[model samples]
Target: MNPRFTNKRVLLTGGASGIGRATAERFAAEGARLAIGDIDVTGANAVAAELGGVAFAYDARDPAAAPQLVEQAVAALGGIDILLNVAGIMTWGRFEETSPESWQRTLEINLSGPFYLTQAAIPHLKQCKGNIVSVASAGGMHPVYGTSAYGISKAGVIAMTQSASLEFARFGVRVNAVAPGGVATPMHEKSTAGRGVDPAIFAEAAGRNMPKLTDRQACTPEEVAAAIAYLASNEARFATGTVLVLDGGQVTG
Candidate 1:
């Protein structure tokens, strides 16, 4: 069978690790030409080398970096057929306890970053009728304790996804998001590691807000990557303004 993404050019953020790395690998396997951007220069370059793609040093929190990253991708790959907004950060704290710096930083990385990247890539996406797939979180859809800032940032992503979908449908460019619950990623591990939040509190929160499924395990990066791939593929041509929740019944149950 022919590869699903043969001749497609894809630009991805956070491509050094976690869901972004997995998604990059998947796209490469499907014959995509990739341009990976991440703050982890060494890691990004390594992935790019292995995948025969290009890598850029990117800080999603920087507005200037957004256009620069897109420009670099376009220059390297000729044009972009897909954009993946997978770079984000999370901090654990209740609304009252969350520091202003933490809140601002979370919003900048998780929400504003995607927004900037999308704005920069829109023209290119329009030219190719390409689609975008963002990695939102289930926390956005439901209240999760000690994740006020993180959840709000993801909620903005969900909102942006739908808004972009509607505004860009006339251009034949689709925008969609995957609202995954806890995914087993280094990002998650690091976020909780140094944070003073009690581990039991997270467990309690998860018990209340997550995994209505029998297997309450966090999702694998590959699983979320697969969902993202589906949303970006021609298989989902008719889908737009859609938030595919991969939260194991978190919303429903």
Candidate 2:
């Protein structure tokens, strides 16, 4: 193993599953000292135990939780060299069809959580000249028929990444993001399961969301994780305020 991050301290959110879980594994394999944060305490603890890292319960909807997670992570790992924001959710609905409650919840977790986490971690990150990598979505860049809340939230993330990069550049803290298209993750099944929305609506949308060049319609969590890892790595040292779009030509098409 290259172990590019040997001894690097990392604090990652959404580490319980999907892109977050894959990102945690990637960082651990690269020899990072990780602190996994997630709402799924059991799953977060499991991942942490397997990787010999610490775990903290984190709910993205709770504004106060971000600072606490950062504090706990800094305490656990000494200081943070990388802050990976991979926790997010997507709810399916057109603008009018979406509920106010659903919209608020989506924004809280997908947008506000990262906002709060970044603010809390900036001081520590500045001390280490650390980098930040967030998982954004191509939906933020392109027009999808039925994902207003998710799209808007992700758009805010992209804006946040860029804005932070500009402000933090003098401090030597790099901020970048990976905007992936649809990914094969549990969020697809879990996000809309109980809602009255028809699952076929998502299916039809997925069909139309295909990449122009690649045969695959969606990326795997590990694939997105790889992009996240790259952005966080020294290999991408010169990159900041950059969004590496990993949609396999979906947007360009």
Candidate 3:
């Protein structure tokens, strides 16, 4: 670890588990003072305790909660140096099969949640010349058969990153996004299970769909976290509005 984020204040949503948990650990290891928000209070607290950080039980879908999350983070950590929007939801279904409720829920968590949080964090991030990192998905770049809502939501996230980057540039706040493909997270496993298809069959289909540059094996949350950490660090000062894809050569190949 470069310790680039030493003493930095980082606020992360969905810091309870999966990619978010990995990211929280990564930042903590790199010497960040973290404020994590998640609906899973127990899990959040456990991770916070381990990292010596504060944890808030929060549902990111509520717009009003966004400012509150920022306020709490600032109060706990002094100020915000990085804001990472890792909170999201996924709904697996064909476009025609997706209900309006499911679509709304997905958009609320994936798109609106990040929008509200980023809006609330912008002022503080500007003050610190900080950065924002949003976790998007490879689904945003290429269409996946059963990820209509998720893909659309992630696409919105990428667009939001670009727009925010341009708008916040004069304020010295950088915005970027990461799009990961086939990460071996619990979320992925759950999404794939009992879908009336063999796990290996689904895996093979996914592997075949990815670009040649992507590795055959799925990515790990830690690997994605590393990319996120780099983008949030001073090492990427000149980088903004870019989406770094971590799909094991899926997108590039």
Report the alpha-carbon TM-score of model 1 versus the true structure.
Answer: 0.95
What lDDT tens digits, residue by residue, belong to model 2 across residues 1-253? 4878999999999999999998999999999999999999899999999998999999999999999999999999999999999998877788888889999999999999999999999999999899999988998998576888889999999999999999999999999999998788888556435354557666656566668866766778998888988999999999999999988898976
User: Which candidate wins on TM-score?
Assistant: 1
Pairs of residues at least 3 apart in sequence or in different chains that clash in candidate 2: none
lDDT of 3 by residue, 1-253 (tens): 4688889999999889999999999999999999999999899999999999999988977889999999999999889999999988767766787789989999999999999999999989988899999999998988566677889999999999999999999988999999998777878777656365445435644534454653345678899999999999889999999999887666665
Flag regions of model 2 displaced more than 4 Å.
Answer: 189-196, 199-206
Work out the TM-score per prediction.
0.95, 0.94, 0.93
Local error of candidate 1 at residue 85 (angstroms): 0.2
Candidate 3: stretches off by over 4 Å: 194-208, 211-215
lDDT: worst 10-residue window of model 2: 188-197
Looking at model 1, which ten-residue stretch has the lowest summed lDDT? Answer: 189-198
In terms of lDDT, the poorest run of 10 residues in model 3 is 207-216
Tens-place lDDT per residue, model 1, 76-163, is 9999999999988877887887888999999999999999999999999999999999999998988688789999999999999999
